[model samples]
Target: MLQLASGSSLLAIAVDRFLRVRIPVTYKSTVTQKRSWMVVAICWFTAALLSFIPMFGWHNYNTWNGTTQANSTSFECRFFTASSRSYVVNFIFFGFFLPLLAVMTGLYCYIFLTTRRQLRLNIGAATESHTYYQKEQRLAASLVLVLGLFVVCWLPLFLMQTIKLYGPKIEVSSLFVHIGVLLSHVNLAVNPIVYAFRIPKIKEEFKKLYMRVYHDGQQH
Candidate 1:
């Protein structure tokens, strides 16, 4: 669920950025507040729908061929144990991650190139264009940072899932999955810190706190 939400939000931001660069005039009118809310609702609905599918008889315990469980002993719940392997391979990897990632990457790349070209032209509204391009450049850079961090934090888990699904079953596979899970959790923590440092108001407060802490440490 966390992954679906984060990936969806990132994809939304990338698409928004692409549109803002590609169609400045129509972008404002097209991306209205009401429509934005609609997108949010759609994301939530899709996440809920996909996650719930496992419960409706598409699970490892009761999916595809037959009961995969060898022992009848009830164990601690795990994703692979509960969710269908077919679901993980088909939807999670190929359906969601691959397509979403491909689109977002293409959009960001287009935005980067367009912004650069606009700067090179610099024909009309010199000051305004300069400011706009600079702002766009900063935004592009920030988006890259955010997206890169997201991939860094989340890729391991997905890769591990892929290996777990396809690769030969081994003892170390469990360790890799555990490490991947830990890394995914790290992303949840890192995103807030990254955003907080980027926001003007929050960044200013952070600086103030840092200075105060430094003074307190020096005095002691």
Candidate 2:
């Protein structure tokens, strides 16, 4: 539920950014703070509702063999696989893929159209537009990279789930499963790094902080 909510929020941000760049006048008038908050509230509510449904026995966690073992400790804890293949399919399609597709489409289309419009301007106007366009390009590129990393990190698990649903029964190695799980978490770590590097203001603040820490250490 938390993951779904977070993904939805990211998608909303992408949409907001797209609107601001592509249709600034309309966005300014329509996408006010109150409306944005309302959208966020709806996303959270929907996420919570979807998550709650599984608790009513729509899904089962006891299907995996490792979970049935009595001696398993916290370190040996394995994630629960859904008992129903349909549940997995529904989750992947609606929860991850659809939202991802929406965000990618909005972001990339905005980038393409915005870039094209900028290109069509006179050379003098183009030079004047460069700074603002560059900023938007950086933001779009950062979001795209984030989305790419998200897909890369989650693709293995998604593929594994799909294979389990359709392919012949074969024992998947625990090592591979663990690696996929680790990769999924790498996005969390990479997000901050991406933002810090791509945003000029953030980069400047980081440099200032680093210099301050270094100077303080020298003084001490």
Candidate 3:
């Protein structure tokens, strides 16, 4: 699941970069495809390494069979009830929410900087050609939408986990915890689909990639 999430995140970033800066006629040919590939590779490697922490001893994990008044799911991803409450709260706060917040913040920052530059240069109006200005707004809107959905879906799970940790006195319903996990994992897949279908250039790239594979199969 972590590996898949990482790949989807990287692909989203690549698609975002292509839309915002690289795919414009002015910049597309000059920015080598290899550079984009490298960026994707780095995202994958970094996610893979970071995700190994829970699997390895950095994040706490354990099997819980204790019976409580309000049942939580047997399978908890963020933190185990058996672990230190403070540590669990910190993990949920910093490990998941903080990073997500940072990424979204960065995206907004990029959008802000891009808009400021365009305004300063007096290129705010749409040119006859497809310039970065024309597409960046729509792309930024889409990214904001995507990230908004991500935060909405995943934030609940983190909040629930944090509540369970900090406010241990309050019992959470098992069904709610399970639902949270479902939402978070669902986020892992949504971004890629949005890019492949919603974004025109990305859809074209996929079409070309598919055609190349199909032609190669026919040749063989």
Candidate 4:
């Protein structure tokens, strides 16, 4: 659900960026504004659908084929049964891993471009050229730093999942899953903190929100 929600939000931001660059004049118009919001709504709806299908048992949880274990944890419904392990493995790999990999790949590409631009600007600055290169460099660095934090925070969970999938058949305890999931959940909250504290626009917005609430409370 977090993946779907956060993914949709990120997708909206990307789409907004694309629209701003591709059709700025149209982006400002009422029609375009309505259409943009419609697109966002569709994306969120689709995300919810993706999350609900497996959850609501259009594809039911897998159980060990024709076998009931006496000593095993029968209370826990085995979502990935021994018989369906291969299918579940593939699903996890392609569904989650592939998309995560793709996102990281894109992040790397962005980092590369940002680094290259910063380096070029720094070289120009060293040569005593009059350029707004320093400001651009700072902006680029900030973006890269945020992206790097995202990668750092998420990579550990991905690595843990991948190892459990393909490596040794060590029994995955609930504790491990809980820890990994907690770490992953922290990323969602951490991202907003980073944006609010480190990004000027977000910081200003935070201040406005804080002041608005404080003033409203005082008036009451």
Candidate with best lDDT: 1
Worst 10 residues of 1 by lDDT: 70-79
- What CA RMSD would you report for each candidate? 6.3, 4.5, 5.9, 6.3
Tens digits of per-residue lDDT for model 4, 115-153: 456567567455432233344334445544555665566
Number of colliding residue pairs in each model = 0, 0, 0, 0
Stretches of model 3 off by over 4 angstroms after superposition: 1-31, 59-89, 109-113, 116-130, 208-220
Kindly report which residue stretches of model 4 are placed more than 4 angstroms away from their true locations once superposed: 11-39, 58-93, 100-104, 107-141, 162-168, 172-174
lDDT of 1 by residue, 1-220 (tens): 7778777888887878888888887989999999999888878778778888877777766534555554557543354667766787778878998898898889988888888888878856567766776687788788788889888877777776776667747334566777777777888778868866665566788888999999999999
Clashing pairs in 3: none
Q: In terms of TM-score, how similar is model 3 to the real structure?
A: 0.66
- 132, model 3: CA deviation in Å? 2.7
Q: In model 2, what are the clashing residue pairs, if there are any?
A: none
Residue pairs with clashing backbones, model 4: none
lDDT of 2 by residue, 1-220 (tens): 6656656666876877777677754767889889999999988997788666666666666744345554545575345454455565467545666667676676877775785577566335646466566667667777777777767787786677667667748667667777877887776677768767876777888899999999999999
Give me the overall lDDT of model 1.
0.77
lDDT values of the candidates?
0.77, 0.69, 0.63, 0.56
User: Tens digits of per-residue lDDT for model 3 on 1-220?
Assistant: 3633543464456356545553456466555689767766776776666555455554334333334323465444443444444443475456655665676567566765765576557665556433646567666666666767777777787788788877889999878888887887787777678777767888899899999999999999
RMSD of 1: 6.3
